[model samples]
Every structure is written in structure tokens, then in C-alpha cells.
Target: MFKIFKLKENGSDVKTEIIAGLSTFMTMAYILAVNPLILSACGMDFTKVFAATAIASAISCFVMGFYANLPFALSASMGVNAMFAYTICNSMGYSWQWALTATLMEGIIFILLTVTNLREAIVNSIPPNLKKAIGAGVGLFVAYIGLKNGNVIVADDSTITAINSHWFTGTPLLTILGVVITAILMVRNVRGAILIGILIITLLGIPMGETKYAGGSFLPASPYFCEFSFSEIFTNHKTLSDFIIITVTLLYVDMFNTVGTLIACAGKSNMIQKDGSIPRTREALMADAVGTTVGAVFGTSTITTFVESSTGVAEGGRTGLTTIVVGILFLLSLFIEPIFGSIPSAATAAALILVGGMMIEPMKDIDYSDYTELIPAFLTILMMICTSSISDGILFGILSYVLLKAFTGRIKQLQLMTWVVAGLFVIRIIIGILS
Candidate 1:
């Protein structure tokens, strides 16, 4: 086990890895609930989607552990699931099976790209400063999600967003207390501080009515396995055109989302080499591709490396052992649905907020004096928080980087593939405007 994980070389041990895995699972287990609820709106069975989510997540995480040997976890992505339900199925008026077909195609394309190393090339093309910015941007993005989840922030019509007025009571208050508890534990050098905080807040919420136990059958219904709609997509010109657009959009979003997340979590784990590259990147990316394909087969959205994996890396996770432990917990969650389902979002929000704080330490590596680098880097971090999309954050960064370089007579500093990527982003943006 030690030899397979290279635990010593990675500066981690089994105990640490286990704790890290628990922390990560606690942070992301909300996906089990959230994914089903979102997808059910598009006329799929909730319990079936829930089962598929756990199964696909477990498979992906295991592959990541054994094949990629990285401390990362994969699950149905929140953004892509929203697109799958709200855009592809609802707005586009396609069946859920048709959306699954698009997701399958995207995953297959991802596998092909990984096999040819084009995905790796895209990662390599990102400049050092932009990479640092992406890491920090992900930090801000995660922290924002934590705040929103804990009700520390609430949506407002006039101001756009505001602090919850009733934050002193209910879930928000418990969330703040949990943050304090976790912060004190960290300061005192407690192992599994994040995990402990989650459990503590969950217990406290019981008395405050913040945690509700809605018991249900533990057995999951069978998923919509092997259901697809290929002929409907190819029959007519309009349907074919829509299919191409939907597939391309899914491909674009999943590609960059996976890239950004892998970069962020890899940076957190200190796994990126000095040359702005990550080892086993192709294998790790292939794990994501495989996850997406398997998810579609099982009737779910695109499964990719989750940014929440940062929670584990922040807890000293360095090797695949951490990932395997997380996979185990996901499987266990299937039988103990009520217990896992009862874990309130506020209970895990503090851990995410704290991990985000840890992840931003890499920002110091950015070159602050160079406007060409500084502005784009700043925009990357700012837009991630504002737009709540990592891919969009990277899109603006790459576009701005290219524009600034070209206009400032520094085009020679930009790589060829960077230009190509920037051009693609521009085309995607144009397509969005037109459609």
C-alpha cells in the first residue's frame, strides 16, 4: 500500500490521508442531494439519479486513486448539471436522454484529447502567473460558495448580494460558530480539525432545528441505465445543429472546468512541478473523462474533478490513498443514506471557507509589478468570485492576456497555443452572443 501510494515520498501517511479523505467527503457529500434535485426537474427519477451519482463518483475516485494516484475526487459537476437540466433539457426542449447523449460525446472527446496529449498541452500553455491566479481564483470561488451555503450571504435585488440579517440565529449562527471552532482547532494543531468541526456543528444544529432528519429507504432505485437518444439528434438539420452546439458547449465547459480544478487542487497539494506542470496529468485527466462517460451511461451529468477536493489537500493529503478513502466513504453513504443526507450544508461550509483561505497562499508567487500579468491575474480572481464560474474566470484571463500582449507589442511573449486558446474563447463568446 505504501509503495503504491508513495506515501513517504509525498510527505503523507495513512492516518493523515484518511483524515483528509473524511474531510473532503464531508465537504462534497452535498452533491448526493443536490445533483438528484437538479436533475429531477428534467423528468428523471430522483432516487435513481442519487444512486447513479454515488456509484459513478465512487468509480471515478477509485480510478483517480489507482490510475492517476492523486489526492482528488470526482463527481457530477454543479455547473454542468445546471446546464443539463435548465438549458439542455428545459430551454433547449430536448429529452434528458438526449442531454445524456451530449454528455457522452463530450466525455469521449475528452478521452481522445487526453490520449493525444492535447489536454496536457492546454494546461502547459497557461502561463505561470495565470496558473497562480487560477489557484487563487478557485480559492475565492470556494469561499464564496461557503458563505452562500452557510447563509452568511444572501441574494438581494437592489444590492445584488448582502449579508444575512438573521445570521445571528439558525444555520448562519451555527456556521459561524463552526468556523470559530475549526479555526481554534487548527491553531492548536489538531488533526482532522475540519472533520471535527463538521461533526460538532451537525450535533449542535439538532437542538437549533437546523438539522432535520427525514428518514427514507436506504436502498437506491435503479438508474436510467443505457438510455440514450442518438437518432433524434442526427435526423434533422435543426436537431443536428442543436446537438452540435450543445455538445460543443459541454465539451468547452467540461474541458476548462476540469483543467482549472486540476490546476487548483494540484497547486494546493504542491504537486505541480517547478516548470508549471503536474505529473500524471494525462492519467488524472483520463480519470475525469472516464467518470463523465460512466456517469452518462448511468444517467447523470458530467462527472469531473471537483474543486472541493481542495478540502482534502488542505488537510495534508498528498497521495492517492486519500482519494481511495473518499471512494470508500461514498460507497458507505449508499446504505446510510439518512445519516449522510442529514448533514447540513452549514456544517461543511466552514471547512470550505477555511480551505479557501489556505489555497490563496500561492498568490504571493504572482508577479505584481507587470501590468500585463497583473491585470489579467487580478481579473481571474475577481471574475471567479463575481461570476461563480471557474471556466469563465479562466476565459477572461486568457482573453485579456492575449489582448494585452498583442496591443502592448509583447506578442512574442505569448505561446502559440495560448493564441489558439484565446481565439477559441473568442469564438465561444461570439456564439453565446449570437445564440
Candidate 2:
């Protein structure tokens, strides 16, 4: 394991990797509960989808660990799952089988793009400032998720969003205390601080009545294996168009989701080189590509590299050993649902918020005086928080950068692939509006 992952070479050891893996898993375990709920609403069996989520996540993380040798985890993406259930299956009147078919096509396209190095070129073409912006934007996006999940922020009728009125009470208060505890631990240079905080808050929640003991069958049901609807998808012209659009949307979303997350977490881990490229770019992309294709076959949404992996990186995970640990835990989760299920979201929310705080350090590297650079970077960060979509954040950033550069006679500074990316975003917007 040491020779394969080069723990010493990556400045990480087995113990640190284990703790980091635990931290990553703690923050993302909510997906086990959430993904099943979302997919089941669209006619999937809850228990089967739950099992599929766990298995697919384990498979993806294992690939990422052994193949990419990165500390990242992979799972059915939250937003892509929503689109699969809410848009493709629910609103569009397509069956869940057809949605899986679209996900499969998206994964295949990702593999082709990765093989051709188009994905790598697109990633490398971004300017350094925008790269930093992606990291910073991810920070805010993550923090926002933490806040919502913990009920630190609540939806309001008068205002679009507001602080929870019961903030001093149950879950929200526990989340706040967890943040303070974790922050103090961080200041003291404590190892496994985030993981420790999650555990501490979970214990505290037991008395607060926020954590409930769940007693039921732990066994997972069988998935709808290989149950695709290819004939239904290709039956007629209108169905074919819908299939194409659904597949394209999934492809576009997962592409940027993977790219933005890789860039953000890579920046956080100091894996981005002086030339602003990540090592093992092909292998990392392939992990995501293969993960998605396999996930669709297992009856789930598109799988992508998770941003929550940043929590593990923050805990000093630098090697694939950490990813291997997460993969193992995910496999274990299938048989111990109640154990993982009992941990409240409030316990993990604090860790995410703090990691968000840590990720913003890259923003200082941006050249503030260059409006040409500053505006796009600023938009990238702001839109991510406001829109709550990584792809949208990157789309606005790239479009603004290309437009500003072109209008200011600095178009020559942009790469050919940058222009190509900008054009693709434009096409995506057109398709979105038409659909």
C-alpha cells in the first residue's frame, strides 16, 4: 500500500489518511439518506436505491483510490440526481430507466472526452485567477450547503433566506457549538479535529433529541440491474430529442462538476503545479467517467468527484490511501445503515463550513488591480454562492472572462480551448432556454 500510494512521497501517513477518510465520509454520509429519498420519489425502490448508492459510491471511490491515487471520493452527484428525478423522470414524463440510459451516455461521453484529452485541455486552458476563483467559489458553495443542512439558515417568506428563529435551540445551536469546538481544535493544531468535532456533536445531539435511534432491517434490497430503456429513448423523433437533451445536460453538468471540484480540491491540497495543472489528470478523469457509467448500471444518477472530499484534504489527506479508507467505509455502510443514519446532519455541517473557510486562502493570490481578471474571478465566487451550482459558477466565470478579454482587445491572451469552452457554455444556455 505504501509503495503503491507513496504515502511518504505525498507527505501523508496511514494514520492521517484513515482519519481524513473518516472525515470525508462523515460529511458525505447524508447522501445515503438523501439520494434514496430523491430517487424513490421517481418510482425507484427506496431500499434498492439506498443499496445502489452505497455500492456505486464504493466502486467509484475504490477506482479513484487505486487508479487516480487521489484522496477524492465519488458518488451520485446531488444536483444531477435532482435533475434525474425531478426533471427527466418526473416533469418530462420519461421513465427512470430512460434517465439511467441518459446517465450512461453521459458517462461514455466523459470517457471519450478524457481519452482525447479534451477534458484536460479545457481544465488547463483556464487562467490562473479564474482557477483560484473556482476554489474560492467552491468554498462558499460548500459553506452554504452546510448552513442549509444544519438549519443554520432557513427559508423565509418575506426574505428569500433568513436565519432560523430557533437557532439557539436544537439542531442549529448544536451546529454552531460544533463549529466553535472544531475551530478551537484547529487553532490548537489538533489532528482529526474535524472528525472529532463530528463525533462530539453527534453525542451532544442524543440529549438534544436531534439524534434518534433507528431500529430496523439493515439488509439492502436488490437493484434494478441493467434495466435500461434504450428502445423507449430511441422510439421516435421527439423522444430522441428529449434523450439527447437529457444526456447533454447530464454531460455538461457532470463535466464541470468534476472539473471544478478537481481544481478546487487540487488547489487546496497544493497539487496544482506552478503551471496550474494537476498531476494524474487523465487517471482522475477516467475514474469519474468509469464511476458514472458503472453507477448508471447499478441504478443511480451520474457519479462525480465530490467537493466534500475537501474536508478530508483539510484533515491532511494527500494520498489514495485516504480514498481507499472511504471506499471501505462506504461498503460497510450498506450493512450498518442505522449506525450511519443516526448521525445528524448538524454534526457534519460545522466541518463543511470550516473547510469552506479554509479554501478561501487562494482568493488572495488573485491580482486585484486587474479589472479584467478581478471581475470574472469575483463573478465566479459570487454566482456560486447565489446560484448554488458549481457548473453555473464556472459557466459565468468563463463567459465573463472571454467577453471581457475579447472586448478589451486581449482576446489573443485566451487559448483556443477557452474560446471553445465559452462557446459550449453559450450553446448550453441556448438549449436550457429552449427546453
Candidate 3:
């Protein structure tokens, strides 16, 4: 293991990698419960979905470790799964099987792009500010998601969101307390501060009627063994146009998160090539594509490299060994679902909010003095948080950048790839409206 993972070469050993892995897992382990809770609305079995989540996450991390040789980890994605469970499965009237089918198809498309050089072209074309803005945007988006989950914010009749003044009630109070304690831990430079916050809040909530508890078997059937039948690919007799749109939506959204996570996490790890490209670009991206396909087969929503993996990188994980350790932890999650599931959303929300806080350092790299870079970058951050869609934010940013450059007589300076992406974004939007 030492020779294979290059413990000396990467300046990381078994102990350090293990600590980093556990830290990363603790930060993202909320997905063990949150994913099932969200997907259960689609009639998925909670125990089965939990197992699938753990398996998919493990597979993705292993692929990243052995294939990409990066400290990145993967799991069922937050934004895409919300769209998958709520928008596609529930609101759009598609069965969960059909949704997985669309996700599987998207994965295949991502793989094709990786093999064909298109993925590299697209990744190379994105400007630096826009990429940093994508990271900052996801930070805001994650924070927004945490607040929404905690009921710290709620829908308003007039304004889209407003502060929940009734937060002193049941769970929201615990959420506020969690965030405060988590912040204090971070301020004191506590090691594994996020995980410490999660545990402290969880323990604090047990006596307050906040965390739920139920007695059952300590172990559940692994979805790897029991849940295969539910997520097989299936297609309805719906209009071809609707099917096409959903497939495209899934593909675009997955790609957005994958690329954004790659760039942000790589930047944090100082793993970027001198030419401003990520090392092992194809293998890393292919791991994400493979993760999505395998996740669908395992009976779960779309899987992708998670932005929360930055938490591991921040903990001084330098090479694939960190990811390998994470893979082991995810597999262990299968046997401990009951304990993880008992923790309330508020506790997990605190961790996500703190992770977001660490992610904003990228925004400092943006060229805020230049309007050409600033406008598009600002739009990317704004639309991502407001619309809760990373792909939409990137699309608007690219299109606006292209148009502004063209009208400002700087079109000649733009790369051909930018125009191609703008065209694709335009076509997707037209199809969205027409269908």
C-alpha cells in the first residue's frame, strides 16, 4: 500500500491519509441520510437507497484514487439529485426508473466526450475568472441549500426567500445553535472542526427532541445486493422531445458539477498543471462519468465528484491515498445507517455551511477590476445561487460573455470554443422553451 499510493513521494502516509479520509467522509457523510430522505419521495426504499449511496460513493472514490490519482471523492450530487427526485421524478411525472435511465444515458455521453477530446476542449475554453466564479457560486449555493434545509430561510409570497422568524421553534433553533457552535470551533482552529460540530450538535439535539431515533436491526440489507431491480433503465412512451430535453438536462447538469468540482478542488490542492489545466483531466472526468453510470445501476440518483471533497484537500490530503481511505469509509457506512440516519438535517446543514465558508477563497483570484471578466463572473455566481442551478449559471455567463465581447469589438479575441458553447447553450434554451 505504501509503494502503490506513493506515501513518501506525495508527503502523505497511512496515518495522515486516514485522518484526511475520515475528515472528508465526516463532512460529506450527511448524504447517507439526506439522499435517501430526498429520494424516498420517489418511493425508493430508505435502506436500499442508503446502501446504494454508500456503494456508489465508494466506487467513485476508488476510481478517482486508482485511476485519476487525485484526492477527490465522489457521491450522489446535491443539486442534481434535488432536481432528479423533485423536478424530474415528482413534478415532471417520470418514474424513478426512467429518471435513472436518463442519468445513465448522460453518463454515457460524458464518457464519449472524454474519449473524443471534446471534454478537454470545453474545460480549456472556460476563462479563469469564470471558473473561480463557479467555485464561489457553488459556495453560495451550498450555503443556500444548508439554510433552506435548516428552515433558517423559507419561501415568501412576494420575495422568493425570507428569514424565518419562527426559527426559535423546534428544529431551527438547534440549527442556529449548531451553526454557532460550528463557527466557534472553526474560529478556535479546532482540528476536524466540521466533524466536531456535527457530533456536538447531534449529541446536543438528542435530549431536545430534535434527533429522531428508532430501534431496528443494527444492519440492513445492502442495496448492492437487494436494490438492483428498482433502478434499471426504462423508457416511457412519452413524446420524444420531452425525453430528449430531460436527457440533455441531466447531461448538462452533471457536466457542470463535475467540471466545477474538478477545477475548485484541484485549485485547493495545488494540483493544477502549469498551463492552468488539471492533471489527469481525462481520467478524473471519466471517473465521474463512470460513477454516474454505476450509481444508476446501483439504484441511486446521479453521482459526481463532490465540491465537499475540498474539505479533504484542505485537511492536507495530497494524493490518491486520501481518496482510497475515503472509499473504505463509504463502504463502512452501509452497516451503520441507523446511527447516521438518526442525525437531524440541522446538524449536517451546519457542516455544509462551514465547508462553503472555506470555498470562497477562490473568489480572491478573480480579476474584479476588469468589467469584461467581472460581469460574467458576477453573473455566474448570482444566477447559481438564485436559480439553484450551476449549469444555468454557467450557460448565462458564457452567453453573456460571448455577446458582450462581440458587441464590444473584442470578438476576434474570443476562442472558437466559446462560440461553440454559446451556440449549444442557445440551442438548449430554445429547445427548453419549445418543448
TM-score of each: 0.98, 0.99, 0.89
Residue 434 displacement (Å), model 2:
1.7
Residues 150-226 of candidate 3 have per-residue lDDT tens digits of 88899999999998989997678888898899888878877666767878888888888888784445675667332
Can you list the residue pairs that collide in candidate 2? none
Overall local distance difference test of candidate 1: 0.91
Using lDDT, rank the candidates from best to worst: 2, 1, 3
Ranking by TM-score: 2, 1, 3
What is the lDDT of every predicted structure here? 0.91, 0.92, 0.79
For candidate 2, the TM-score is 0.99
Candidate 3 Cα lDDT to native: 0.79
Q: Which stretches of candidate 1 lie over 4 Å from their true place?
A: none
lDDT over C-alpha atoms for residue 120 of model 3: 73
Clash tally, candidates in order: 0, 0, 0
Residue 53 Cα positional deviation in candidate 1, in Å, after optimal superposition: 0.6
